[model samples]
Every structure is written in C-alpha cells, then in structure tokens.
Target chain A: MAKTVTQEFTKGLWEEIAPFRLVLGLCPVLGVTTTMENGIGMGLATTFVLVCSNILVSILRKFIPAKVRIACFIVIIATFVTVVELLMQAFAYPLFLKLGVFIPLIVVNCLVLGRAEAFAFKNKLIPSVADGLGMGVGFTLSLGALGAVREILGTGMFLGMSVFGASYEPFAFMVQAPGAFVCLGLMLCGMNIIGSK
Target chain B: MTELIKMVVVLVLLSSSSGGLLHWLKTQTSSKIEDQQVKFVKGPALKSIFEGSSNDPTADRFTLKVGETEKNFFVGKFDGKTNCVAFEGFGKGGYGGDIGLMIGVDIDNGSVLGAAVTTHSETPGLGAKAKEDPSFVSQLKGLSIESPILVTNDGGKINAMSGATITSRAVCNAANDAGKIYKEIKSQLTEKVKSF
Candidate 1:
C-alpha cells in the first residue's frame, strides 16, 4: 500500500504542488512577487525552512506524543524560520530588506506545517526529505513564473532589463496588489485546464 | 501518568534546545547584521549629508556613550581638515512613528552643514518628501546648531511642508535632538575629530 520514495517526491512537483495544486501559502505569493528576484529569494528561504523542519520532524515523529504534536512541530518550524531570517540578514541583506516582515511570517506558512503534519510526521526519513525537496523546487518555479509575468507586464522589464523598449508604456496595474490576485487566479485557471485534460 | 510525564519531558527538551541554538545564532550573526545595516541604511544617509568631504565619513567613525546608549559619529574631512561630524537622532511623535535623522554639523563654524532622513515611516508623497525631496532639509544647512529649530507656524524661521506638518515637525525635532547631543559632546567630539 506504500508509495515508492520517487513517487512521494515527484507528486509534489505536479500532483500536489504547494501553490497551484494545494493552493496554500498565498501570502508571500501575492506580497513579494513584485520582482522576479524577490520571488526567487522568498522561495529559496521557504525551501530551506521546509527541508530542515521536515528532516527534524521526521526524525522525532515516533518520540513526539500525538496529543502535543502540533506544538512540537511549531517549535521546530519557528527555529528554522529564525535561522533563515538571520542567515539572510547576514549574507543577503538587500533581499532580506525587500522581503521584510514576510521572512518572520514564514513561521506561520501553512505549507511548511501541513507537510510536517501530513507527510513528514507519518513518513520514513528518506521519503520525507524527497517530498520536501520536490515541493520546494516546485514552489520556487511557480513563484519565479508569477514574478516574471508581473514584472514584465507591470514595468516592461525582466530582471530590470528593458524588455519592451522605450516606447512600451508599462501597464502599471500588474505590479499592484490587485494585479497579484488577477495574475494568480489566471495562473490557477490555466493549471486546472491543463489538469482536466 | 507515564504518558503525561513523557510529553512534558519531550516538550522541555525541545524548547530548551531551540532556545539555546537561537541564542548562539543570534550572537554569531549580530555583528554581521549591524555591518549590513550600516552599509545599506546609514551609509547612504551619511554620504548625502557629508557630500564634498575629502574623506569617506562612513569609514572614519567613532562611538561615544550618550546617556545609556552608545552612538556612532562619522567625521568628514574637507580641504584636508577634519572639522565636521555627522550623527543620527530620533524624532518623537511622527505621523507613523519616530523618524531617524542624520545631522551634520561644522564644528569650526558651529553651524549645521546638512541634514538627511535616515529612516522613517511617514506617509508617502507628503511626509516621505522629507527624504525624497532635498529642499526641506536644505533649509537647515546654514542654521546655527545652538538655536532651536522650528517651523514657521511655531514662530521660527524654517517653513513646514504643506500637508506634512507632523512629519516636518518630526524632522525638526530630530535635528534639535542631534543638536542637543552635539552640544553635550562638543568637547569630546572635537577631541575625537582631531585624531582623524
């Protein structure tokens, strides 16, 4: 009845992708996708927290009592989030500044917690690691794609290079908060259409 | 009873280890984080205020104990003479919160050299103009540091930005605070500047 490790890992890439399939962790998805760089930076930070927390949770699952498992999971997650925050501040201060409060807010991202509770807590160590890595890569790709669309349409630039030339007036609306919602909705709709077929 | 004891024991071990690890990490990264803040946030503010100085003010700095906290003062060398210093001050009761101002004073003339906003959360287009637009702060360039700075509405010389009185007042307050610090440490500052 158990799935192979490869199956567990690959599922997160498409079948159970965090943002598109599970529709989770939308706060950062909407907030920091103003630029492609910011989106990628936020994605990598979340990925680090996810993988580390997953490993720790999986290792300790048998020892942690079910009655207080959520609380234990939180402590583990919070520790990793702070580690990500501090490391970013030290090495990538500019990105840290751009991400701002969202870094600390990673502690409450449901995707990290959901994985720990649903998959890591019940799975073997290698499978948990695979699942975490696959999910992380998928999330990074989704955010990068979203960020590219918003940046290009909103500013007529990609990674700060003028893409549409001087005459291409920026749409302006695509970078704003409302634009994030519409962009995400369209992306989700497109995903469903492809999935249905 | 045994199950309850196990839960408590597990929680205690996890919390303590987490706390200990975080404490160690904070200590390791605190200095690096400070360097980043100095480079990104305070560095530009100091550069603008110390414009035309022959030396890099950010690199030539000294710390002095003011009240209970230590404050870093950057020295600007103009014409091969170190006669100016820049430091930061906090203005209370801004529209959003306290505004941070970096004030540069010419010790030789006992007058303000320039001022720049280091950090603030004031409203954009109005209060934010304090940092974005240079005109508001340029007015303080030649004013004597000994006199109290105020907006025109407060029966003083400087004019407040229309629709941003709160933010304007905050900037003025921060200048006044820096002036007060300058006065209190005038001797020590002059002494330190001489070494540069």
Candidate 2:
C-alpha cells in the first residue's frame, strides 16, 4: 500500500504529465509561456486549481452519482479555478494579466478534470492531493522548460533578464508561434529520449 | 422518484454554489485586478513610451482628423501628457486566427512607445512572439512619422520574425497605420498650435 502511494505521488513527474507525455492542456502550456516568469505563473495557478479540485472531487466521489459525475467534477473544478483566478488577481496581478484568460480556462484543463475523474474519484484524500501536486509540478516543469528555450535563443534572454550583450541580434522568430511548436516538439523528443534511457 | 429528486437537488446546489462562489470571487478581485492592470501591463507599456506618469486609463475615445481620415482611438494619459494611445485592427490571418494588437503611442512624438496583444488566436510560438518579444516591440520605438512601416526583408526599417512572415507583416502593418495617423495628427496639431 505504501509503495503504491509513493508511485502515485511520483508518477506525475515523468509517467503522466499533462504535456510532453499525455499531451494534454497544450493551449495554456504554449500560449502563455514565452518567458520563464509566465511559465511559473501559469504553472502555479494551474497547480493550485488541480490540487483543490482533486481533493474536493475525491471527498464527494461517493456522493456524486456516476451519470452526473462529470458535471459535478466541472463545478468543483470551476470553483477552484475561480479561487485561483481571484488569488492571482489579488496578489500577483502583473502575472495575472500576463496569463490572461488562460487562468480561468484552467476549469477546462484536461489535467484537472482528468485527475478528478481518474485518480481523485478512486483514491483517498491524501493520495488524491499527492497526485494533484505531482501532476501540477510536472506541468509546471514542462512550461518552464519550453519558456527557457524560447527566451534564450529568441532574445538571448531568460525570464525577461537580458543575458547577452548588445552584440546579439536575437533570433526574433524563436519567440514567435512557430518557434513555440518547434521548441515544444524538440523538448518532448528530448524527454522521450531521456525516459527511454 | 427519490433518485430523480436527489439528482435535481444535487445539480441545483452544485451549479448555484459554483455561480455564487464565482460571483463572490469576482467581487473581491475586480478592483484589485483593475489596479494591478494599471500598475503592470498598461503602466509599463506607457512607461516604456513616456518614462513615468501616473497611470489613469480613461476609456475616452477621440477622433483625430488626420487629413481626410478620421482616426478613432483610446488614449492613456498620465498627468496631462499623453502617455500612450491604443488602437485595434485585424491582422492577416495565419495558422492562428486573426491577430489583434493594442499599439501604445508616445505623445512627445507619434512614435510607438509600447504595445500589447489585445486579442490573438495565433499559433503557439511563431505568431505569438509579437506580443512576447520586447525586441519586436522595441523596433517600434523612436519610429518617426517619416519612417516607412515595412519590414527589413521588404526593404523596410523593422525586422520580421523567421517563419512568421504573415504575422510580422500584420504587426508592421498596424504600426504603419498608426504612424500614418500620427503624421497627420502632428501636422494638424502643429499647424493649430502655430495659429494660436
């Protein structure tokens, strides 16, 4: 039982990330992540929503009938997402605008709903929370990794801080939309290579 | 009968509670969000154009008679100086849908001081970079009314992003449109000020 718990906690790190592996929630992952700051902001917001929704869904799992389960799950997820959105606005307003609607759209993020239906509904409270945390971290890392690549090559910068001197012209396209796909695909490929080994 | 009642009750409670929670949350955060919006995005975009000014964004729209064309726009003024002026238009469609940009123009001159993505459904990295890149935006600064608003590839002043030709052109086009309006405004205002 303890071994299974540990696996659930760690599984999100590599085995079942929303992006890269399962290939879920690609919109916000790619949309807001032009810089490391944006990626971190988006990651933490999504994580907060995931953890809260997962716990709520798990607690109400038995009470919620299977036919209405998805609707119940959406309501729970939307509540947590609103909280996350409000919290970001209250405290991290700059990051909030930077993130834009992607924050509210967390309600529909496959990762949050996926966890509620997959692990949270089936697991106990502690394990559900653990799974959410693990998955959130995995998603965050994925966004951060993608942001780092785009920022560095596209602008010779990282997280808005300029790393290169005036000599650099910066590959302007690397920060553009095409660069986002190329970077994400290459990163996923790299992750695949590492995982295989 | 019992099961149906229970299902109805549960859905009612769930939806009402969710709506109530969202309403409460929005009420609590709306003011803070508006303040932060001024402090961060709008403020910074304006500061990049005008250095520093108290951010007081008015939704007031103005029609500047630029020759025959009457340009309408939202002006962000800081302490009497026009910090930034924002205007919107559709971009050439690409892999992403229509790209919309809010160009912030500096008052000292009609130069593009800063800009932001008002609306976009562009592809993840390529077209979206126009919003994310300061370099792409920076090129707009210090731009005079005399400068042609074309990309470097097309023998223009601004640099276009690799693999994002259509997107880059779209942005450059907005800047050009704004720059043209600015020229007419400058000439009109200068003549008006001289007459006074």
Candidate 3:
C-alpha cells in the first residue's frame, strides 16, 4: 500500500527523528541546548525551515538540473534560515541570543538537505510537508528531553522555573558540554531500547 | 560560452541574494540582538543579587548612587534589618576565562551570606565545579572579615576543587575582592555618616 501523508508526518516522530533515530543533525543536538527553552526554540525553528524548504524544493525539483541540485538546495535553505533568524530576533530576542550562532548554522544541518534530496525531490508536495513537520516535531521533542535533564540537574530548575528549592543542590557539570554528551548518550540509548520493543 | 555565462549568472545571483538578505537581516535585528545579548549575560547576574531579597535603607548604594567613583551595587534586607550587600567582582586568572562572582555578605556581621558564579567559561568537569559543590563553598561562610579569602592548601578557609586550581583560586579571589571592596566602601560611607 502507498503511504499516506499522515503516515509521513507520524514517521518522523520516532522512526525518522533527525537526531535521535536518524543520527542526523548531531552537532546542534549536542550543542545550543543547555536549556529546555533553547532546545525547544532551536528545534521549532529548524522544523519551520525544514517544512518550508522541503515544499519549495519539491516544487522546483523539476526545474533544477541534477548536476547543481545541491547548490540550488543550499541557496533555498539559506534563504529560509535568514528568514527564520530575522523572525526569531524580532519576536523571540532572548531565545535568539541563547541560540547564538546555531540559528544561522541551521542552513548546513544535514537533516534539511537530506530530506530535500531523499524525500522532497521524489515525493509529492503534501508528503514532503508532512515529513518536514514530523521530523521537526521529533527533533523538538528530543531536544526538550535533553534540555529537561540538563536544566533540572544543572541549575535545579526547569525552563528557568525552579523545581528544587534553596535547599536542593544542583550538579553543575550537567549543563556543560560534557553534560550534553552524557545526557544525549543516555537518551539515545533509552530511545534505542524503546525502539527495539 | 552561453553555459559559462549561465554559470556565472547563477553564482552572481546566489551571492548577491545571500549578501543582500544577510545585510537586511543585520539591519533589522542588530538593535534587538544587542539588547538580547546584554540581557542574556546580565539578567541572571541581576536575579542572583536582587531576586527574593529587599534593599537596606541605610545603604547608600541602595539609593543607586556611588558618587564620583560610579560603582553600582544592591542591598539585601531581611525583616527590616540590613542582611547582606550583594557585591560583584571578577578574578583575572581562572581556568577558562575571567570568573565573575556575585557574593552576598551580611551587612551587620560582615560575614558571607552566600555566593554564586555569575559568569565563567571554565572547563566543564573541572573548573565549573566551583558553582556546584556547596560543601566546597560552605568553607567561606562565617569566616572572619580579615583575610576571609583563601585556597584549600593555604588553610585560611574555602575548599578548592581538586584538579581545578586556577578556577578555585579565581573564585576565591573574586569572593575575597568582593568582600574587601564592600568593607572599604562601607567604611567610607560610615565616615561620611559620621561627618554629617
């Protein structure tokens, strides 16, 4: 049976997760996600770009030559990234600063290009859009999970809201770069275990 | 020749578009971006000092004036009694970069109330440990005002994180300098009060 648009959308939630399941976009997943909000913001912004870029690339797929497809895709992705960057600065200035260079770096995030080439170029417009949404949500969810663990342990708080009172001690290493790896490693392992079941 | 021209055209189009878009973005977002970065670095520092605390009336800095010297600080009061002066200072040689500390010192007793690392680029597992372990920081509490600053090896007070000597020294010095500056400022203020 042919896959439905909804199936495409749902697949990214688990089976096709950009970082967790697919192992794509590992750099940003492991970086710029010290806080839950930062992770959410980055994930959602990436998703927005993925969805829009996929749709545009798919629509223009036939018009572009195979030899220069990568260049074309990059130009499209970069434009969307600029748009996302500007919008975030205008509306979500604090989150934008927290994201730092990661916002612009999204242009090279492999997941967007991977989808555009593998799925968007071949699939219909609706399926490509769904895939983008699914992947984005999956990425967002994973980042939020990573952020939750880091934030809570790192500063005894969640999303800047204190979960642990003054008496509660925080583990500072959990918020550092090493902590990002530790958390992501354990999470990926957990995801694998659940996926096997 | 047409193909070469087409390639050049594409390249130029791509370059101009990207450059134009980036320039537009910078123009639109530079102010907000600057404001956001300032908030990102300073917001938490402010919260660590003033959140969940009150200002002391007798404190001159509480009125937000430092005279010509132009230093800014916050006063924390508990039950109308001046509890602490949240003072900030920096250390020159931390393991990573300059370590910034916000220290709360008791106004009456002149002892430390608490301390927080407001900024640091210290190595994750090692130097950053200063911000974590309370047992390490508890060494600073109730220590006398004279030479309250120390390293674990020197035995004055304050436990140092193992293998993070530079960071340990930096934070300790920061706390010490903050306390010392507060004392100097407080004495000056008192002299002014006496003269009046």
TM-scores for every candidate against the unseen true structure: 0.96, 0.63, 0.59
Give the winner by TM-score: 1
Give the alpha carbon lDDT tens digit for every residue of B1-196 in model 3.
7666665666566658768877888898886765554355544554554456554322334322344555445555566555555656777789778888876666666777667777888988888877755566556667654456888587756667889888889988888777667766776533333332
lDDT of 2 by residue, A1-197 (tens): 56466788788888887798889889888788788788878998899888988888888887887878898999898888878878888888877768888988988888889888888998899899889999999999989888888888988987667888878899988788888888899888998899999
- Which is the winner by DockQ between candidate 2 and candidate 3? 2
Alpha-carbon runs more than 4 Å astray in model 3 = A164-167, B1-11, B29-196
- Tell me the TM-score of model 1: 0.96
Docking class of 3: incorrect
All candidates' chain B TM-scores are: 0.95, 0.56, 0.63
- Those runs of model 1 whose alpha carbons end farther than 4 Å from true positions after fitting are none
Of models 1 and 2, which has the larger lDDT?
Answer: 1
Best by lDDT: 1
Worst 10 residues of 2 chain B by lDDT: B187-196
* Model 1: residue A143 alpha-carbon error in angstroms: 1.4
Candidate closer to the true structure by DockQ (higher is better), 1 or 3: 1
Instruction: Give fnat of each prediction, in order.
Output: 0.68, 0.61, 0.30
Give the docking tier of candidate 2: acceptable
Cα misplacement distance, residue A34 of candidate 1 (Å): 1.1
